[model samples]
Target: MPTKKLGVYPELLTSIEKARQLIIPEDRIRVLNPLIEYIQSKIDQGQEINLNFICTHNSRRSQFSQIWAQTAADYFGIPANCYSGGVEITAFNERAVASIKRSGFKVSAKGDANPVYYVFHSDDKEAITAFSKLFNDPINKGSQFAAVITCSHADENCPFIPGTEKRIPVRYEDPKEFDNTSEESAKYDERSLQIASEMFYVFSNVKMPA
Candidate 1:
């Protein structure tokens, strides 16, 4: 599929492209290559690619990873599913949601406890459904999914994810550190962009079928 087929929002396209330029340190790509290889192997076998990003709170970084990874898959014309969860359920932080909105996504929320959000990167593309839930939530695949631990705490605490084929610890710094401080928005957007950059890199590196 041609890149044009993605039809992502113009603003988001700009952001993703910019994020791509920001990915640095050749070692980071080396670190992420395993994940790229795993997804590629699944695609080569014509298997469904399911990624479950987990964090302790399921609030910020994990949510961004899910959204960006799914978007990157779509942008690359790869058939994959992305989901996010935590060890314990907590609402997707409003601050993180705000940062994504600033990044050009359209977000609509419903309910309170673990409210579901329909996040759209473009008016033409289907929205990504996001919320807080357990890693094994019924909405997520029960087996054969890669468990991507996005925080050190979750990775250390949940040593064994029951049925995951691969467990990748691709940790990120918590933007929560800056919460209620003057740097809140900037740091949140910074973290979101960093994840977005890495996700784009992963999908961009995949050897999609011709």
Candidate 2:
């Protein structure tokens, strides 16, 4: 059985909820509550969650969102599964993995070596394997999912996700520009932290107790 516990990173958990509270009069949480309720209820009924995060390139924003989502969910004891993909064909760069590692995540590369789309693990027994893969219904073994669009591009370009039961657009800035800069590590770490914060915040608000 999976558990949802607010772990050592309590401040980050609080930060996520705080950010949501600050997002504007409406940040889609209202409409999203029904979906959230449904997902949580499914968990109550012993269903596993599969989430997919999408972006234009599947390199940075979407990848970061997927990793952070799983991490945050794990931290909170939620048995949620996460995946990522992009609308365009782009390889997952080595620099991105370096950034993730630098951000204090254990990274592993598996699957094909295309560099654009590869599979990676977080090195934690419970952590989901993170990867840069194309978004497709077939990838998760015919699983209907909660689809999250992490960038404006993918959200705007691909509106209907065939296997998704819920589609949520939560755009984040591109960290790929920090690619070769001296600040690349810091910038990517910042993005990871940002994603981690929000995901944990959203997970925290789910009413069902573990």
- Among these predictions, the greatest lDDT belongs to 1
Of candidate 2, the 10-residue stretch with the lowest lDDT total is 116-125
RMSD values for the candidates in order, in angstroms, are 1.4, 4.8
How many residue-pair clashes does candidate 1 contain? Answer: 0
Off by over 4 Å in 1: 1-4
Lowest-scoring 10 consecutive residues by lDDT in candidate 1?
1-10
Residues 175-198 of candidate 1 have per-residue lDDT tens digits of: 999999999999999999999999
TM-scores vs. true structure, each candidate: 0.96, 0.73
Could you tell me the lDDT of residue 165 within candidate 1?
Answer: 97
Tens digit of per-residue lDDT, candidate 2, span 1-210:
125343424443444454345442255456345546656876887777888888887877887777767766676567777788876656566676776665555445555654433332333435445555678824553466778888888888897778777787788788878778898877876776667656656676665552
For model 1, name the residue pairs that clash.
none
lDDT of each: 0.89, 0.65
Which one wins on TM-score? 1
Clashes of 2: 7
